[model samples]
Target: MVIKLTQPPKEPKELGVEEFPRLGIIGGSGLYDPGIFENAVEVQIHTPYGLPSDNVIIGRVSGRVVAFLPRHGRGHKYPPHKIPYRANIYALYTLGVRSIIAVSAVGSLRPDYAPGDFVVPDQFVDMTKSREYTFYDGPRTCHISIGLEPFTQEIRKVLVEVASRYNRTHDGGCYICIEGPRFSTKAESRIWREVFGCDIIGMTLVPEINLARELGMCYGLIALVTDYDVLVPHQPVTAEAVEKMMTEKIDIIKRVIAEAVPRIPAEIPKCGDVLKYACV
Candidate 1:
């Protein structure tokens, strides 16, 4: 069942400023619990958008304060299209999280980007049809520019360095985000691979990335390649196969996060000031 907070809990006044989590990790499919967090506390946050997918888990990783949120809730109850992307990002923002590392399982579009590999996507193409893609929906509209690069380079550099030490890691790639509770058709998958030159495909990146940018928070993705998206002449991608692959490779993913957390710089250069020029 989807978890929602009927009454928002007040932030504890006893907690010091240093205790606020600076790093946020949004866990994707099969990643309900971030097994690496220590001294974890579940904080139910209520955002202007609504309840986040689940309670934000505040914990320590590598002795640094970090927050973990499961994108699909504890039981994977929310579909990609139905995910509360706005609320999720907003909830993290309220917790003083300045940088976010989004961990997701994706289907590889190219043959070389094989299964059980890790990719740090520098770019993303949003093909999602229906979802909340932004935060400034009303009178106070802000035109957030994501022109140069969508993902945070500061975080990307750290993730690339840390992930390479563990497994087969692609330094950079293009992620195509589609609206889905369903996998791609063969024809559509081929076009994304051949025509669009997309390296990876997944469902829930759009609004999450956009909202983070709007909030001026540094955001980066560490995509775990789960299966070939039907373009390769192998078994057609299935939910079962994706889950199996994520299960096998979760250890490697966790290791990357554990190592990368401590290395991410506290002040990511231009990411925090993104809204300065964005608001008209």
Candidate 2:
């Protein structure tokens, strides 16, 4: 069922985030939380790509308008590779979400990045076998820049600053997106860390970030470290341990989002005019 909230106030010339139409929050595993919204309503959004992973929740947090969606449907129905990345991102774009905050649970690959630490990744390495990776494909083609600056740096900075106030947060790192319904094997994990030089590992965040870029939206990821991915053969990471750790750290994630939502800038030049000279 689709539910809609009352319209928020008009954008003021002051240019604060609260005046924006929507600030999107894409929740990853153990992070489909909307409790921070004081008066949230569930809204179903049908997109040209398809239905988003689940109903989007729109509400106000820290006096800012926020839209939250569970990448995996409630009860965790979709796997990482199966998530409707195109639909989810397109829906947010249609709903006027200029900026996106992606909250994902990930396995750390570095010794310094311990379990329960938070990382705002600045770059991404996509290692998925299948998933639609772009908004423009055939009739017309356009290339969006995801090379030097994959994720939006401005939003990353806001996430880092906000998280620093509440949790141990790494300001920058590289995220590796793997195709997974299952955890990585020791060899694969080691290759990702040693060869790929990825600091954290996850399944989603690939096409989602790309699609956001195609449509000229700012995207940033807040990766919560739940465990070490098979890199340390001696320290086995169990599903149970990951769930428990993520559950314990959920509060910190909420706090970070609450503080960061209001800080998104009113405008970004990187995202502006993205399609102006890209289509060919």
lDDT of 1 by residue, 1-280 (tens): 2233444333533222246787899999999998997767777767888888988887789999898999999999899999999999988887778899999999999889999999999998889898888888777878988968898888999999999898899988999999988899988998998899899999988889999999889999999998998976657888999999999988888988999999898878699677887776
lDDT of each: 0.87, 0.82
Q: Relative to the unseen true structure, what is the C-alpha lDDT of residue 94 in candidate 2, on a scale of 0 to 100? A: 67
Model 1: lDDT of residue 193: 85
Model 1 compared with the native: what TM-score? 0.94
In candidate 2, stretches whose alpha carbon ends up further than 4 angstroms from where it belongs are 4-20
| For every candidate, C-alpha RMSD to the true structure in Å | 2.6, 3.9
Pairs that clash in candidate 2: none
TM-score on alpha carbons, each prediction: 0.94, 0.91
